[model samples]
Target: MRDFSCFSENGVQVADAASSSNASITTSSSKIGQNLVTCVYQCRLRNFSSFIITITWTKNLMGQGVSVQIDDSTNQCLCKVEIKPWLFTKRRGVKNVEVGSKLIDIHWDLASAKFGVSPEPLEGFYFAIVVNQDLILMLGDMVKDAKNKIDASGFAPNVVFVSKKEHIFGKKAYSTRGQFCGKGKVHDIMIECDLMGTNDPCLLIRIDGKTLMQVKHLRWKFRGNFTILVDGLPVEVYWDVHNWLFGKLMGEAIFLFQTCLSAEKMWASQSILEPSWSGSLHRDPHTQGLGFSLVLCAWKNE
Candidate 1:
């Protein structure tokens, strides 16, 4: 049984006065009694925008802790406050696991442009999944590089704390996880595409799949620019598609992603395998054109 009374602030957990680094808190869910709380040290990472956090409480507090990693867009401490009472008793020989959400809205800028190649936050780039409230996996840059064959995937501490059921209440551990797109219900499908590659120009088309297409006819219009339409209707698909396409061409990759309001969707993105550089003005010999792509994946309501 982890100790919930040892916390200081409303949700701030304070460890020993001598060890503030390990300070954590506990909060109760309206539906349940109390849930464990985890904190991300935002100040520690100088130029980062988000922090991933995880929590662990007793079975009475939901058995396993409700783990969800949230991005701090405002550059503040984003905490996951679970209001449920579920006791989590660890089985002597069984392994418990849980997969959380994805951080699919990360923006890439100059910091990642050095080699004409950009990289997601080495630590905060991936999604966090928890098991039985003890074991966890922070899959970020490691999985990516591993997938790319540039690095290895075997890393520890990537899997956080682990403990038995009866010993959870008064004990302390660390882990992280988050929710993306779904509000916790469950979404098994997501469009997975990379916005960082140069050789290949990928196209993502957005459409109203729910609606019927007449003759399957589409028009392409270029007014000092490129434009495309669906069912003879003007849309911003061109802009959205190009942004993702050229961003990858320019070497800025979209490691994270989201979608729009309508059901049907399409867009284009590129990627670069080598390091490159970009400048504002054209140089003497290499009249390099400054190319920029502005892709908007998440729907914006005006």
Candidate 2:
């Protein structure tokens, strides 16, 4: 009888945000919600079966909370659970769920977790999901603790980070960190573009401290994709800053850096996503790694 809220059982959970005095978090879906982070992972069961799991971690007036959703190949959700911010409750717990006649267990520990500017836990935390007694998907840095708590049976699940949808707030310059490959170093990603008064604006992307790519005359190229090298990996960067340059005062921009995939091919396959702000975070679940997709939905703070 855990205090978890079962938002969706074999379906979808509606994202609704309300105001509270909590003061830290601002929104619900991370799309409409401010100060939120959403991560999506594709994992296969030991039986060669696969599914998509979306985890949205949010902070708002009430507190910091997390919402998890599991969906099948057809995008039909299986089960979803929410861990709302609480006081006097265990920051770590376990959940037993049933989806499609399968028994799944979700374990989490974040008692000592430390966070930076983002709501997502940076370290000292773990979120593990077990299905059929196999470690299907696990996240966080406390691997030894995770292994000790769960039964490490069968083979490790073939998991791939399909995509991420993060809402980042900034004015002219927005920055974040990214690891292009599991073995590659995490580089500081900064996107600097000015849309103040100049008509001939430019989009500049920097890795760590070095400028990787710069697009001049951005007004004519506000919506396009390009490839740049970071840590010796070809990362395709897609950007849609239409609203930022033309629409609203504090409009948001969408940028994506998908490695090991051609921005041209991804651009051609508009059916999948088309690399636009309107497109939800999507990727081929069967996509093999060392490939990962990073989406930054940047909202300008006026």
Candidate 3:
């Protein structure tokens, strides 16, 4: 195995080192047969304290479901609510949990939620998190219904999407969608690596069907990174495919799409590796001056 401790400066590390430090990544990656999409958002609660809300959507043999977790700036878990797999009576419900002295309410109605190939819902759903009677985070297209049901109205919650982590499986092509910046247009991201019956494998990455980066001599350069432009923003693309090139048959590859305007400055500083799997959600985005990050764990399907 390659020593990844030295690559901390560039925010890239070997899978073993990365997984050992991040419990979430280890947990998600171990579920090789399931599809998971975890989104992290930063928002200030009614008390003016910033908190991180992690929402994870899961799809497996049982069915599809969602889980919500709130953690304070100190990385202390305040509360968590999990909506079990779909069933007749579990389609819609509300859960109230007391965090410290504050009561947090989680409301969701996924009975009519529509899903695509991904576990995340596409429409016909409303997921709202209320704190101190104020709607702090809201998701889905049922905005009017959410507002009516919550019975709290003022201005929209000031939520900043911090990062996203998804687990995708494919034979030779892995694909997903991502929004590089806030309120930016979503684009299709496709990663293709054909290693079957060939002496050499090449890596091709495309955005919106347009090739952005291509690497030859895959065996010699299987683990590296490059800079790309998306929506006029500087994005640092990193990949670690050591497992794919040399590890077990079911080994997965990790790709990170990090958007940070100060990427140049960041590269200059001696910072530890903060790959998407490293759990960037624990850090405050505003204070860190970090942009959105998307981490895709691509598993090769046999």
Index of the highest-TM-score prediction: 3
Give the deviation of candidate 2 from the true structure as CA RMSD: 12.9
Clashing pairs in 3: none
* TM-score of each model, in listed order: 0.18, 0.80, 0.82
How big is the positional error of residue 230 in model 2, measured in Å on the Cα after superposition?
A: 1.6
lDDT of all the models against the reference? 0.23, 0.70, 0.73
Which of the two candidates, 1 or 2, achieves a greater lDDT against the reference?
2
Prediction 2 TM-score vs. true: 0.80
lDDT (Cα, tens digit) per residue for candidate 1, span 1-302: 11211122232211121322222222121111223232221111222222333333222323332333333444343434332212323211111222243222211111221110011122422333322222124434434532333222232323212110111111111111222122221111111222233344222221211111110101111101122222222222121223233333322211121222221222222222122211111111111121112221221111
- Which is superior by lDDT, 2 or 3? 3
Flag regions of model 1 displaced more than 4 Å.
1-37, 41-49, 52-58, 73-302
- CA deviation > 4 Å runs, candidate 3: 1-34, 85-88, 264-287
**Top model number, lDDT:** 3
| Ranked candidates, highest lDDT first | 3, 2, 1
Candidate 1 — worst ten consecutive residues by lDDT sum? 215-224
**lDDT tens readout by residue for model 2, 112-230:** 88887677888999988888787878888898888778876843567877666777776677776656654356566677777778878888776655555666677777776666666
